[model samples]
Target: MRAVTYDSYASDNSRLKVGRVPDPKVGPGQVLIEVRAAGVNPVDWKVMTGGLDGMMDAMFPVIPGWDVAGVVRGRGPDTPDFVDGDEVMSYARKDVVGAGTFAQYVAVAADDVARKPASLDWNQAGGLPLVGMTAQRSLDRLEVGQGDVLLIHAASGGVGSLGVQIARDRGARVIGTASEENHEFLRGLGAEPVAYGDGLVERVRELAPDGVTAVADFVGGQLDTTLAVLAEGGRHVSVADNTVDQHGGHWIWVRPSGAKLAELAAMADRGALTVEVAGTYPLEKVGEAFDASRTGHTRGKLVITP
Candidate 1:
């Protein structure tokens, strides 16, 4: 099978290369997917640089992707939930950092794969799982609901964009932080956009004078701002900063869950959610895709079609 692989960590991402590798084996409770598209994320580059080495063991020549949209080519024993030719998407992060989704084929645990939303094309579906699930987990942990005012930092980025829509669907008033260029984009997603950086606290206050009832910090280094603008007794969570926990907010990590992805699919099908794709790259252009992701400015998801 043709796939991207990195022999070892490199701060410069110099090790990523495309080559033929052994096909992934289907084990019990797993399903082999014929890869159609894969999502490029900051973590993919981070993993290449050994950022997650402390948490996940790596095998040499690691395949570098987690989000996938594809067709089930086969299923392992005891996996009765899907059949051959089923269209699916998954946050396919294994406990070990190898055998990833940036390939012609990938074998994912059945519990981690979900049927793709009918409304999303391959690129959108491929980009949906990780960012979508991350946003869902953050909102769920914050208990965001009707009558709540939610502030999301970096709200125009992949996860933040999805977070805005999901929070709005739950009846929360969403205040999203983005650059001046993306303010209209955020507004279209049902959020009141506030430009980040200096005066962020004041801007948020102007929108919600009592301060926001919840803050979801998708961008790190906003702890002070998060603390300053949160309403009294409000909840907060951050995917980027663990220090948030020390300030009475939760630091969350998204766990792979097909059930949660299915819920997101339902939201998409019902018109309550939509994925924004900034661009798409072919499998051979994984390096360029990673370069774009590292820029920290794309307004939506970047996808790789294999």
Candidate 2:
């Protein structure tokens, strides 16, 4: 199988390469997938640059990918829900759990693999898992629904874009914070986009005249800005950092769930959801894509096709 992996914790800005490697083996409770597309997330590059390598579970010479989409090539004896030839999507567990999907094959645990939405191609399917799962889980944590007013930061980025759409689908009126330039793009997605700069709180207040019922901060800076606009007791969920302070919300980590992924799949199947591919790169160029992601203004999900 051809894979893109670095031998050491090389700085992505300095050195990273892509080439061929051996295929992965499927162990008990795991399913082997012939990788088609891999979703590139911020964590992949962070790991590459030694951001996460300090953790005891992170190993060197690691292939840093979590989200995957492909056809099943093998299934463990205990994996009764699926068989070979099934199309699947998965986010390989990162801790001490497993490897990644940056290669042409990945052996992911069966519980982590969900049927890819039939309406989406491999790249879309691959890109949706991590960000969609994250957004869905974050909203779940926020408990957003009908009549609720939700505010999402970094509205044009991968998770935020999907988060805005999902919030609206669930009957919430979403107000998003992005740059003035991407405001139109976000408004098209059913979110009222506000400029995420000085006076963000004032701008958001103007949009939602009532009050922000919830805040999902995909952007890390400006905690005070989020707090200034949040309704008392409104959930302030942050994906990148702490959401805790005077606002009284929780810090959220994106959790992988086959069940939640199934729900997102259903929405996409019905055309209630859509994926915006900001860019596409082959596996060999993943490092370059990763570098771009860190720069802070991706229009949508960045993907890597193997």
Candidate 3:
């Protein structure tokens, strides 16, 4: 199997190299996928630079990716959920940072795998899991539902776009903060778009004079801005800032669940959710994919076709 391997942690993209590696061993409750596409996220590059070192250990010669959409090549015993040639996607992070989705094949725990949404192609499926899960988790934590006015920071982003759509699907009026260029994009996702930065609070206030009933911050450093526009007794959550807890907001870290993934896929199938793939690179050009993700300005998801 060929994979992108990095032996050491560094804030450098050059450390990632493509080479042949042994195929992963399939263990009980695991499924081996023949990789079709992998989503390139900020965390992929961050992990390469040891950003998650304190939280999780990495094995040497690490294959660094977590989002995958592929075909099931094989499965281990007791995995009754899938069989050969099943199309699936997963947030396939394991206890260690090796045997990742950047490879031609990756072994994922059955509990983390879900049947790929039939409505989405490989790239969209590959890109949807992580961002979709994060958005869904944040909305869940905020208890966003009917009659609530939801404000999402960075709403044109991968996770934020989905957050806007999900909040809308739950019957909430969505106010999303993005740049002027992405306002129409957020509008397409059913959000009232507001420009971020200076006057963001005022802009959001114009749309929701009583203050928003909930706030989900997908971008960091917006604690004060969130506080300024939040309605009294409203809920708040942040994936980017742990300090949100200090302000009576929940800090969310998404957990992989096949059930939740399946539910998201069902939403895609029902035309309630969709993914936008902004850029793509071949397996060997994963470094370029990482470069695009590191820019933090991509309007949609970046993907690697392996």
Candidate 4:
């Protein structure tokens, strides 16, 4: 199988190359997916540069990706939840950093793979899992729901955009932070968009004078703004900032769960959620996708069709 592999950590993405590698073997409780599309995320590049060295041990010549949408080509024993020919999606991160989704195929634990939403195309489904699951986990930690005014930092980015829609679906009034150019995009997702930076607190105050009841920070370095705009006794969570825990907020890490992905699939099927794919790349263009993601400015998801 041909896949993207990086032999070592680099200051840049110079080591990423496409080449033939052994096909992933299906282990017990695992399912092999014939890759159709894979989502490009910041963590892919970060991991390549050894950004997560302390948290996840990397196996060199690592395949770099986690979000996948594909057909189940085979299954291991005891995996009764899915069978051959099933269309599925998964956040395919294992305990180690290898055997990723940017390949002709990947084998994932059955507990982390979910049926793809019937309404989404391959690109959208591929882009959904990681960002969708991140948003869900953040909102769940904050307990966002009816009567809450939720403020999401970087709300136009991959995870933030999905967070906005999910919060709105739960009856929360969403106030999202983005630049002037992305404000309209955020509004389209049912959030009242506010410009981020210098006067972020004042801007959010103008929208919710008493401060928001919950805050989900997708962008790091927004702790000050989060602290400023949060209502008294409000909850907060951050995927980017670990210091959030020290400030009485949760520092969240998304876990793989087929069941949670299934819930997101149901939301997509019901028209309550949608994926915004800004662009698609072929398997060989994984480097380009990573370059775009590193810019931190794309309005929607970037996908790779293998």
Query: lDDT tens string, model 1, 33-150?
Result: 9999999989999988989999989998899999999999999999999999999999999899999999999999999999999999999999999999999999999999999999
lDDT of each: 0.95, 0.82, 0.91, 0.94
Consecutive 10-residue window with the lowest summed lDDT within model 3: 287-296
| Model 4 lDDT per residue over 108-200, tens place | 999999999999999999999999999999999999999999999999999999999899999999999899999888888999998887888
Q: Once superposed on the true structure, which residue ranges of model 4 sit more than 4 Å away at CA?
A: none
* lDDT measured at residue 10 in model 4 versus the true structure, 0 to 100: 89
Residue 15 lDDT (model 4): 95
**lDDT (tens digit, per residue) of candidate 3 on 90-145:** 99988877778998999999999999999999999999999999999999988889
Point out where model 2 deviates above 4 Å.
13-15, 54-56, 243-247
Model 1 scores worst on lDDT over the 10 consecutive residues at 9-18
Cα lDDT, model 3, residue 210: 94
User: Would you give me the overall lDDT of model 2?
Assistant: 0.82
Model 4 lDDT at residue 5: 94
lDDT, residue 101, model 4: 94
What local lDDT score does residue 32 receive in model 3, on the 0 to 100 scale?
A: 94
Best by lDDT: 1
Query: What is the C-alpha local distance difference test score of candidate 4?
Result: 0.94
